[model samples]
Target: MNKKYLFIFTIVIVIFAAFFLLTKKPQQKNTDILINGKKLQVELMQTEEEKTKGLSDRKNLCSNCGLLFVYNQEGFYSFWMRKMYFDIDILWINKDRVVDITYDAKKPEVDEFESPRTIYQNKVPADKVLEVNAGWVEKNGIKVGETIVFK
Candidate 1:
């Protein structure tokens, strides 16, 4: 009787564990960006909701941290400083190659929150746009022709 009860307990535990695992949501994949032989930890903004909230309400960013905005096709996209506290470097990227660079985009003034926002746009169309800390482009030797490999 003891062995039979133990077997039933084990089966119950396995069933509960399987049910718990199956009910859990799938985890999202992390976006890894490698540029100029350097790997950067990035947050991907694939959906419109995520892209619209790009780096806003942030006070600072760590070194080598990036916000990657992904699009379906290469097109002209305009960005504006909404609620950022520090400056950022915006890069226009098409696939693995860099298309353009907008260095040191200034932070918006808190006093001017009700005023017109400053728009930042690149000259060419880009399938992806990368936003990093200001001066990161020059410090990391990132150039327009450099390829960014995503993993």
Candidate 2:
């Protein structure tokens, strides 16, 4: 009787464990961006709100982390340093190729009344925009006409 009871208890425990494992949520993959053969982790800004809030009010960003803005169509998109705390390097990409690069875009001044926030835009239409820490492009040797791979 003791052996039979122990066997039943083990089977019940295994069933519960299997159920829990089947119902557990899977983790999302961390997106990696490759530019000029250098890999960097990036967060995708797919929604309008996320695109609008790109790095605003953040004190700092990780050296290898960046934000990638996604759009439905290729169009001339403008970016401004509104409420930005630090400088960034902006890359405008069309399809898989970089169309333009804005190096060391400065943060807005404390008083917008004194110094108006400057807007930056690409010369050509772009479907995506990437923002990384200032000097990241130079350090990684990223340039226009280079391919960007998302994984």
Best by TM-score: 1
Q: List the residue pairs that clash in candidate 1.
A: none
TM-score of each: 0.81, 0.78
Instruction: Encode model 1's per-residue lDDT on 113-147: one tens digit a residue.
Output: 43437899979889999999999999989999898
Highest lDDT: give the candidate number: 2
On a 0 to 1 TM-score scale, where does candidate 2 land against the true structure?
A: 0.78
Candidate 2 Cα outliers beyond 4 Å, as residue runs: 1-30, 113-116
Kindly list the per-residue Cα lDDT of model 2 for residues 28-130, writing each as its tens digit: 5359988898888988888889898888878999999999999999999998888888999999999999999999998887896234469999999999999
On the 0 to 100 scale, the lDDT of residue 132 in model 2 is 94
- The number of clashing residue pairs in each candidate reads 0, 0
